[model samples]
Target: MAVIPATWDMYDLIQGVLQAPWYHMVFEVALVLLIVKIYISQSFSPEKTVLTDKEKETLVEEWVPEPLAPDVPDDHPILKSMEKYCIEGQNGKYVTVNGKSCINLASFNFLSMVGKKEIEDEALKALKVYGVGSCGPRGFYGTMDVHLHLEDDLAKFMNCEEAILYSYGFATIASAIPAYSKRGDIIYADENVGFAVQKGLTASRSHIRWFRHNDMEHLESLLIEQEKLDKKNPKKAKVTRRFIVVEGLYLNSGDICPLPKLVELKWKYKVRIFLEEAMSFGVLGQTGRGVTEHFEISPDHIDLIAASLETAIASTGGFCCGKKFIIDHQRLSGLGYCFSASQPPMLASAALQALKMLESKPRILVDLRENCERFHQKLMNMPGVKVIGDPISPIKHLMLAEPAGDPGLDVRTLEMVVDNAMNDGVALTVSRYLEPEEHLPKDPSIRLSVNCELTHEEIDRSADIISQSFQAVLGKLTTRSLDVSSPLNSVQQDNRSLKASR
Candidate 1:
C-alpha cells in the first residue's frame, strides 16, 4: 500500500507540472510544427531532369572515354630490356632455356623432386581419373578423394589438427588473413615480408604495424605499446585480436626468421602467430619440417602455418595448417576456397608423393643444406656483388657492392649480368618487385635458388661465370657530361655512367 501511494504521489507531481497553460500549448505547437515539417518534405521534392535524345547524344559525344589503365611508352625500361627465354622441359638440377641446357639455379626445385618417377606416376594416375581441372569450387562438386587425402597427409605431416587447400599459391595466405582478421583487428608484421604477405595485410583491412626486418627489440617495443593501449580500453581490447605475421624464410630476403624469439614474444604478449613457410617448408630443418623444427620449437605454439607447394613439393597451389576448428571455418569463410575452383587432383597427387619421399629420404634436406652453404660461400667470392641470406637458406640474393645509386640503373645492370650468365650456360634471374607497392623495397639483385643436385664443380663454375659477367658489365658502364652551349667547348666524362641509354 505504501508503494502504491508513492507512485500516486509521483503521478500527481507530474500532473501539477503539466497543469500550467503554457506547457500544454507548447506541446501542441511542437506537434503541429513536426506535422508541418513532414507535410512540407512530402509536398516539395526536387523534380527529376530529363534530356531529349539529341541532347543526350550531344553530351555523350562531348565526353571523352577514358582508358581503363595507363598506357606504357615504347621505351618503357622493363619492356625494352626484358628478354623472353622459353624453357624446353622439366625443372631439374639442369634445365633448358632457349635450347641451352644450364645449371638450374633459377628454379625453386629445392628438394630435386621435380622429375621423380614416383611423383610423375601419381600425377599420371590422377590425370587418368580426374582430368585437368576440378571444374567447380570445393563446396560445389569439386572436392575429390585425392584432395581430402592430401589435406590429411598435410595435417599429419605438419602435426596440425587439420588443413585447408587453396587453388592458387598466392591466394592461400591472402585469403586466410581476411577470413580471420577484419577492420578492427591489428597485425604486426615484418617490414621485409614478401609481396604476397603485403597483399594479405592489405586485404585483411586491419591496422598494420611494421617492425624492422628480423629485429626482435623493435617488435617487443610495439607489443609493449599495444599492451599499454589495451589497458586504456580493456573492453575494446577484449574483442580485438592481435596477430604477429612473419615468414619462416623470407621470399624477398631469403633469411630465416628467429622462431624461438617470436614464440617467446607470442607468450609474453598473448598474441597469436601466423608463420608463412613457403620458402622454408621442405628446404629447412633436419628432415625438412621447416623453421619451427629447425629451432626446436613446437608447432603448438604457433596459431597457423601457410605455405605454397610450388617450392619444395614441385607442384601448384598451397595449404594452411592449424587447429580443426580454425581450418573448418575457412571452408565457409575463405573467399578463395569458397569461390575458386579446387586445385587439380594431379598436382595434389604429385605433392603427396613428394611429401612421402621427403619423409622417407631425409638425406635430401642434408644435401640441400650443404649445397646452399657451398653456393653461399662461392657467391660471396664473386666480385662487385654482396650475398644476402643465411648459409642454410635455399634462396640467396646477390646485390651490387657499390650500387649506381638508382634502382632503374641497378636493375638494368643486373639484367645485363643475368643475360651474360645465361649465355655462359648458367641460368640466373634478377629479383623483381612492384617497387611502388613495396612496404620496404629491396634493391635490385640477382636472386639464386639452390638445388640439392648441384655438384660442387657446378657451383664453382656458376660462381666464376657470375664474377666474370659482373666484371665485364661494370667495366663497360660509363657516364658523360658536356656543355654544348659553352663559349669555349669543354667536356667532362667518367667511365661509370648509369644515366646514359644502353
Candidate 2:
C-alpha cells in the first residue's frame, strides 16, 4: 500500500474521485431521481390501501364497530310527538309560545327575572364592554372582575365564607364532587338525586351507597351500616373519607330533603354533607337563601353548598360556596373549573343583577310560595291524581293513581293531559327522569313549576285546566278498563245463571 500524508488536501481527494468514474455521477443522479420519484408517489397516494375482500373483512373484524342503535328507542314515551312551543319573550308567568300567548308553568323562572329589563340591560352593558366570552379558564387569565364580584355577592347572599364559580350549572356539582372525593372515598347519595349529582358521584369513582329519597331514617340506617363496615375494616376506613350528598329540593320528585335531619346525621356519623341546591337556591326561605336558611340552620354546618345560577338567577353558570378551605381546594382540583372556559361576562352580569333583584324584592319569594301552595291545594283533590312534594316547593309532581298497565302508555297519557292543558292556553311539562338505569319512581308524573309572576287568576285557571284534563283522561281510562272486564263479567254471569237453572 502506498503511504499517504496524514493531512491530505480535500481538493486532491475530490480530483481523484472525479477522475475515477463518470458512472458514479450517473448512478448518483439516477438514485436521487428515484428517491424523489418515490417521495412524490407516496405523497400523492391515498393514506389507506385498497384491500381485498378477505383482508377488508379481517381488518373490520379487528377494528370496526357493530351498527349502533338510536340513542333513544322510537317507542320511548319521551319520544312520542307533542306540540312544541317556542317562547318569544321573557320566560315569566305568561309567555308567548309559538305565536300564542300562554300562561307559563313550564319554566324555572322562579323569581320571574329571566327577561327583566334591568337584568337584560345589565347583560347588554356587559356585552358591550366584555364582548362575549372570557376566552379561557378561570385559572388562565379567565377570571374577570365581574366573575369575582358575582362570587363575592353569592357568598354574601348565602352567608358563606367563600364561593367559587363554575362555567356551567351541571358542571358545578359534577366538578365539585370529584374535586374533593376521589377513589376509595364513600358517598351516601339519595336514590332520587338529579342526574347532575349522579354524574358527579360517578366521576368521583367513590364507593357510593344510595338511600331512599327524602327518607331520613333510611339514610340513618345506611350510615349505621357504613359505620359498622368501617369498624370492621379499620385500616382501610382510617384513610377513607365519607360524604353524604343530597339535593335541597329534588328535581325529579319535587320534594324537599329534610336538611335538619341530614345535618343531624352529618354530626352523628362524623361525615361531610354536600348540598345541591339547584332548585331551592332562590325559591326557599324568607330571604331565598335556600334550604339552610329555610331550616334556620347555619351555613357553616354544611361542608359544601353547590347551586346552579341557571334556575332562579336566570343566568348560565353555577357556584359552590362553603368554608374557605373547602372551596379553595376546587381552584386547582376541579377539572371543569380549572380547564373549561369561563362563563360569558353578560351571563355573569345577568346573574348578579338577578341576585340584586332577589335581595331588593323579598316579596317574590312569598309570591312563589303562595302560588305553589295554591296549586298544591287545588290539585290535591283531583280524581286519579296525587300531588307529591312540599306545599311550599315551586316544583310539584302530579302522579297517576293507576298506570295504564305500561310505563310508556302512562307517560303518554299524562303527557296528553299536559298537551291538553297547553291547548287550553296553559304551558305545563312532564317530569322526565334523566337516569333510567338508576332507581326512579314507579310511575312518571307531570311537573308543574310555579313562578312568582303567576297571578291568583292564572293559578286558578291553570289548576282548573289541569283538573279538567286529568278528569277527562281518567274517565276514558276507566271506560276502557270496564270494557276490558265486561266480557269476563258476562261469562261469569252466564255460568252463574246455568248453575242456578240446573
Candidate 3:
C-alpha cells in the first residue's frame, strides 16, 4: 500500500484504485445494478389510492346523481288505456294477432305479395346463400349481386336511366333529399308530405316553403313569389337550387298528386321535381311503373323518384330512380346509402321476385284498382263518414262528419271506432301523425289499406262494419253529451239523425 501524501489528495488515490483490474469492473457492475434497482422500483410503483371504508362511502355519495324524470307526462289516459296489438304471423290480407285471426285492413300490403309462397321461397334461397345481413355499408364491400339486380330491374321497370337502393324505405327519400339539397337551398314541399320527407328537409337545412296539399295554385303562387325574390337577388337566386317535392300519392289524405300539373309548374318555375312514390309504385300504372305511367307522362320529366319496397313490393328497403348522373351522386352523398348496412340479399331478392310477379301478372294491379273503387263506392254511401282519396288509390281515409269539439275526444272517439272494428274481426287503424309537430289533416280518420287479395265480399263487410261502428260510437258520444248537457249534444244529435236517415 502506498502512503498518500496530503498534497497528493483524493484524485491520485482514486486513479490508483481505478488502475486495479477488479475496481473498474466492480464499479461498473455496481452502478448498473443501482440503475436497474431504481428503474424497477419506479416502473412497478402502484398508482391506486387506498381509502378507508368511510372515505369510500363519502366519495360514492358525492359522485352519485339524483334520478331524472321525463319532461312530458307519461300517464295520459289514452296512452295508458291503449293496447299495443302485436301480429304473430305474416301481415297479409289476414294476420294472426294475439293468437286470433283478423282480416288485415291495416297493413300496406296493397299487392298481397308479402306472404306469397313464391316470394318466400326466393327469400329463403337468398338467405341460404348470403346469410342474414350484409354486415357493412354499400360503399364498404357490401354491394351484393342481388342489390345490383334489383336496382337494374327497378330502373327498367320505371324506364329510368339508373336506380339506387337504400337499406330502409324511410331512408330512401330522407337520404336522397339531403344529398341534393343543402343549406341556403329552397324546397317547395307539399304540406301533406310524409314524415320521411319532412325529416329529410330538416336534415338538409334548407328553407322550406310548404304549399297546401295537392294545391297547385298555392304552389304556383309561392313559385311566383320566389321568382320575384329571385329577380331581386339575381346572384343569390342563381346560386340557390330550388326543388318542388310532392308525393305521388299523399299518405295523410289518401289522395293522388296531379303529376301533369306538377310537371307544368316545374318547367314554368325552372325548379327540379322530386316525386316520392312510396304509396303509388307497384300500385299504379298499366305496368306498375308508378304515377308517371298512371298520368301518361315521361318518367324523364321528373328529376328524381323515390319509392319503398315495403309497400306493394312487399320487401324491406327502398329505391331512387332517375338519370344516371342524379342517382350516381347519391352513392357518395346519400348518408343512409353511404353509412348504413346494405339491404340484405334476401330482401333484395324478394323485392326482385315481387317486381317480376307484378310484371308477369298485371292482373294484380287491376284487381287492386277494382277493389279500391268498390270500397270507395261503398264507403261513399255510409252516413256521417266522408271518404277521402282517388277512387283508384288503394289507401282510403274515412273521417267523421264533424269533429267532437275536443281533439282528445275526437281521437278517443276515432280510437273507439277502430277498436269496435277490430273487435268485429277487422284490423283497421287510425291515421295518427308520424310527426305530430307537423300540420296534419283537420279531422282524424281511419286508414284502410285495400289489397288485391281482399274479396268484394270482404270489402262490403268491412264497409258495413265500419258504418255500424261509426254510428255506434257517435251515438254513444251523443248520449254522453246529452248527460253532460253540453252544446255538442245538438251536433251529435244531428249526426245521429243523419245516420238514421241513411
Candidate 4:
C-alpha cells in the first residue's frame, strides 16, 4: 500500500511485522528445502550407478598397476647386464659416467671438434678482446666484428649472399617464421619437421596446412588448394603467398630431406622454401656444404637455409642464410632478428674457425660419413636392430618393437641402453623423440651419432655394447610378444633408392 505524508501516523500504526511473519516463515522453509534438494541431487544416486559391486571390484583390480619392486630389483637380470658401458670423464675416446670410463657414441659433437687446441685458443683470444658476453640486443648495441665475420663465413660456406645470426637455435624458427606471413598467408609444413618449427607456425595467428612426412605430392596438393582459396578472394589473392617449411633431416626417423624433389617443387609453385639443416650441414655433401651441395644444387636454388652451428660445427648458436635482399629484409623486418641478442664474440669466432676448418679439410666430413656407414652396417648386421636414415648421415636410430604393456619402457629402455653403453665404456644419448609423444610407444628406440673423430676400434666397441644391450632387452622381452620390421627398409624401398652423390 502507498503511504502519503498525511497518512504517516496511520501507516506507523499498522501491524506490518505481523502481516509479513507468515510469508517470511514460508520463504525460509522453501529455501531450506531447496538447499537440501540440491545437496541430495548432486550426489551418487542409485540411477547413476553404472556398475554392480562385483563389476566395480573387477574394474578396480584392472586399474591397479603391477608392483614395481618385484620387476625392478637391484639384482635384476636386466640391471646387472647393462652396466658395462659406463665411463667416468669423456675424453677423445671415452667419457666418464657414474665414476667409470666409457667410449662415447652419444654426443652430437659430429666433428669431435669442440675441444680442439687451436679453436680453444681462438675462443680465449676473443674472450680477451670482446669480453665474455654481448652487452645488449643486436638491434640495440651488441653487433661486433666477430659476429659479422661469422655471418660472412657462414654465407660463404653455405654459398649464400648474406647470413644472420640468432642466439638460440629454436628461437630462430619461432621468431622468424611468424613475421614472414600474416592472416592471409598459407603455410605448408613437413610432417616430421622439428617441434619448434611446427609450434612456431601453429602459434602464428595465420592459417596453416600440413603435408605428409616428406610427401612432395601432398605438398603440391596443399599448394593447389591454396591457389583456389587465393583466387576466390581478391583480398587473399593480393596477400596470400605459399611457404613450404621443413627440416634438412627429421630428428625422429633420421630421414634426410629429399632436396632435389623439394627444389623442383619450389620451382613449380614459385613459392618460398625454408629448410632447416641442423643435423645435415656438417655431415653431408661433398665438402660438407649440406643438402644443396649434396644434390649439387646451387645456393640460388634454395630461398633460405637455416642451421645451428652447435651441431656439426662444434660451436654454439644458429644462422639463416639466403640472397642479399632476403637476408637484409629479415635483418630489418624479422622480429627474431631485430629483437634477439647477437652471438657472443667468442662463440662467433669459434664458429668462424669451425667453418674455415670444414672448408680447408673436407676429410672431416668424409670421415664422419664413413663413421656413420660403419655404425649403421654394424648395427644392422646385429640381430634385432633397425638403423634409420641414409648411410651418409651420422644420425642413426635403433628401435625395439616388443614388450608392449610396460608404460615406462620408453624411458626405462633408453636409460637401460644409455646405462649399459656407459658400462661397456661407451657413451650414447638414447633417442627421446618418439617416447614423449602420446602417438609413440612407451619403448621407442635409441639414437646414435658417429663423431668425425671416431676410430674403427671405437666403432667396434660401440657395436659390441649395442649388441649386448639388444641381447639384454630381448631377454627381457621373453615375457611378451613383439612385431619387428625395420622402418629403414620401408624408406629405402618407397622412393627411388638414389644414393647420395658425394
The per-model lDDT (C-alpha) reads 0.88, 0.87, 0.89, 0.74
Model 4, range 236-297, lDDT digits (tens) per residue?
A: 57766778888887776788888888888888877888888888888779888788888888
- Tens digits of per-residue lDDT, candidate 3, 1-502, equal 9786786788787888778789777988999999999988855667899899999899998995656965555765436445456668688788876567788999899999977899999999999999999999999989999999999989998999999999999999999999999999999999888889989999999999999888889999999999999989999988999999999998887899999999999888899999999999998898888899999999999999999999999899899999999999999899999999999999999999999999999999899999999999999998888889899999988888887655655777888998888788888887777435665545677888998988888888888999999999898876777674665665566667876899
Q: Tell me the spans in candidate 3 whose CA falls farther than 4 Å from its real position.
A: 1-84, 434-436, 439-442, 485-502
Q: Point out the worst 10-residue segment of candidate 4 by lDDT.
A: 434-443
What's model 2's TM-score?
0.82
Clashing residue pairs, candidate 1? 478-495, 478-497, 479-497
* Model 4 regions more than 4 Å off: 1-93, 403-407, 433-443, 479-502
Residue lDDT tens for model 1, 435-501: 7898877888889999988888998998899899999887766321134443212221222332363
Best-matching candidate per TM-score: 1
How many residue pairs in model 3 have overlapping backbones? 0
For each candidate, give its TM-score against the true structure: 0.88, 0.82, 0.82, 0.74
Q: In lDDT terms, how accurate is model 2?
A: 0.87
Better of 1 and 4 by TM-score: 1
